[model samples]
Target: MSEPESENGAVHEAQWREVRYEYTPRLADILAHLRATIVVTTYQAGKLLVLGVHDGKLQISFLSFEQPMGVAVGSDRIAIGTRRQIHFLRAAHETAPHVEPHGMYDGCFVPRTSFYTGAIHGHDLAFGRDGLWVVNTLFSCLCTLHEAYSFVPRWRPRFVSQLIDEDRCHLNGLAMQDGRPKFVTVMAEADEAGGWRPNKATTGCVLDVDTNEVVVRGLCMPHSPRLRGDDLWVLNSGYGSIGKVDRAAGRYESVETMPGYTRGLAFAGQFAFVGISKIRETSVFGGVPIAEDRANLRCGIGVVDLVSGQTVAVFQFLSGVEEIFAVDVIPGMLCPLIAGASVDKQERDVWIVPQPGSGE
Candidate 1:
């Protein structure tokens, strides 16, 4: 019941939680055959979803963040993993307006930089070669962003030794690769404290950051590992599946199963969007298997078909969103928009010249 959203007329700046987004005209013909634009973060509806397409309809844009979990999409930049900060969004594209069959720019995306690092349960966000790599999950570790210190830990899951806040091993999910920090998804390699709250279903695994090992154990509550091209995609979220780890036969390969409780993951060519959720009866969603026969829980997005693993398209959400924690993919964006900050036309325009002709 919150839904505010306004920009050029600038009054209400952000409020979202009245979601109701549905898709499946083959998910708008697969976002008009991959012209792309599907951002989504929803850390339990603190919201930040874009999901575009213009004239033929289906827009759905919203911003307001606080719990907005992990999402990283660079090129024009966007980092977002809020709940203690790490905003950093850009991409105004010279004031945006050029529209028409692909001049493309209904896009806005505004925050320009935040990076606080307090709550520590930060979860995924990756840019690497050493820059914005946070998954600090209450210090199970993989941090970076300390120009004054709050984080800078780097990597830790060699069975998590120190730097404590005791989320022990709920170390969410992260996977970078060439830019570094290669793989991670935990729910239980348990060091203590919440000890992954009684193995949230199956003692999930998938560690392997250069053989620190645990290359895929009996996962069920995995989250997003994604590193496609030589494969390493994960999202076994308490058994709603979407696997693919095998790092030289350590085992994980499921690749498709979605009706709820999968966690966000993204990728475009050959597909794989994943991110389902909604099993809420709590005690951390009871005995898994997508909460067994609870009439098949379901929240949204499950495109999958990384070469025939199935689920061709879906976008369901039949109500004001419930869960969905990160799903990037904005390649060739179609109709993006953000403008928030109570928008006085994106903050009454500012100026800071010096890089088009330069000797200013």
Candidate 2:
């Protein structure tokens, strides 16, 4: 709740970067009601933000990372994909009450391990039956991490002739079903370097990972395909809409369109939490419907009522954040704290050890 202040009462530049934001009063209420915490990564700001409710107020904890992109949350672990490494953190519930402001947080994620994946531009991640599944955008394939090598290739679009760092198809979203990678969303089926950039607005499609077949086509730069129950949901990013893929009809059914470009998506009960970002006004973002009104674009998380397809609450950034890469809901955790990788000495001091009389 406190920000660094200077002599004139303005935020200080030398201290930690100031993050200004606003949210509907109900946003905190909704999170508290569900007993959940929202985690979002903003590569543009190199931050992983944890949003929760503390005493009927919005509490935000910012952790530093190097261009953090993909985030995967499980029952007891959280995985974060950065520029050149993937960090794994395990929740140490035993020590949650000791986290300063003692008892304010109900969960504490302590960094436990990391794997160097080079600069593969890894995207969406999910824990599956086989372990961690990553959308390796640079190599145009789905891969898993290993201790001996950077990554082990699992699946790729048949159109991609070889594994290379060209970002050929811009394969960025992965949806896992029944503990396995089921579907993915890509900008295009292009097989050449940067080939998906030109027609990104119209060539985006979703592919079945098992069959390597395009399930739906002609999307508007789609990202974050997810399976909620029996429905296949995806973000039509360029058009700023959240929709579902009608597999039988081979088309996308728009559910709700937000005010900004949408990318990240997560589901909690009957609600969908979506990440919204402003258009960059570059050729990369041109020719998109949402880009037409850049002045009204917003950067925040929109809580959508899936049953009604209407946004019920919003959390907006007034400054210091422009884009969001991933969003995930941490269920049953009202407030949580994440120790950033090497950001402060506190992480070094915190330790996780077995309880007395526990087996070694």
Candidate 3:
């Protein structure tokens, strides 16, 4: 077991694990009384909550609908963009808007009828130096980064570029380097059009954002990538592994594996946090994800030491909730959370999500 240095010598984050319920608000003297925290992400059933750690609490933002696949995070206010609707919300743990019971919760910032006027799919979003980049992954494939305050036609959205006609895989994960784009996908230019299947074990490439061209291929279902020093540390979901890419050598190596389908990787200080979906029902040594397997692999948040390559802490899912999409550890706060999944909406675990001053 991984051990962390604490006030008491070697304490593990596991000492504070519980079901995702509303029983306790903060940490209790005893570990057993803690309730798991699951923030209401706004992706599909609400998207995954994307967190950027700050002072003592996590600043959470998520996406919704189809086009606005990004959320705006502010110091005291936050906004989530849906297809044509955007909800500018006050920060949470329980902050509410000045509306009535329903409207009391920060409501829509933009209406749904205003976005996706034609046929555009927003794949990724990032905070630009003075704007935001909303990527459209298919059809007339394009990457457009816009000014943050340029929310109207007067400023105009800047078009990065389109992929080569032969590069057919969806441009899903994107990052900005020095005010430009760096993107990754499941296939590349030399790839056959329909070869971008999730089940197959394939490694495509990472696009050089400046020229919007394919630079690296042969990635194993890579998801979250962070540009560290001279390497790109990426969470490769296909092998349940975290890897680093030699930017100059163009090689991939498996760092470690948690033995499940993994995605959403984030770094806090010296630790790496990864989100693993339900334990692959029944994965066969790198085959596609199996469908009917009903086994849950204690999914939650896993914390590892980047330097030593050891998993020191884990916060498990509870109260029938089975999966977490992402975890963001804000500074100061002992427990950090971003987005998680309820059993389902029919039996929703609303308590997992938090606002500025909410009790329920």
The most accurate candidate by lDDT is: 2
Instruction: Pick the TM-score winner.
Output: 2
Better of 2 and 3 by TM-score: 2
| Model 2, span 197-237: residue lDDT tens | 99889999999989989999999899999999889999999
By the TM-score metric, which is better: model 1 or model 2?
2
From the highest lDDT down, the ranking of the candidates is 2, 1, 3
Over the stretch 246-319, how does candidate 1's per-residue lDDT look in tens digits?
A: 77888888867777788888888888888887877778767777777557577877887777788877777666
lDDT of 3 by residue, 13-52 (tens): 1224223421111112111122122222223334443332
Model 2 reaches what TM-score against the true structure? 0.93
Q: After superposition, how far is residue 4 of candidate 3 from its true place, in Å?
A: 14
- Give the RMSD in angstroms, all C-alphas superposed, for model 1: 17.3
CA lDDT, every model vs. true structure: 0.75, 0.88, 0.43
Question: Using Cα atoms with residue i matched to residue i, what is each candidate's TM-score against the true structure?
Answer: 0.36, 0.93, 0.57
Clashing pairs in 1: 220-238, 221-238
Model 3 score (lDDT): 0.43
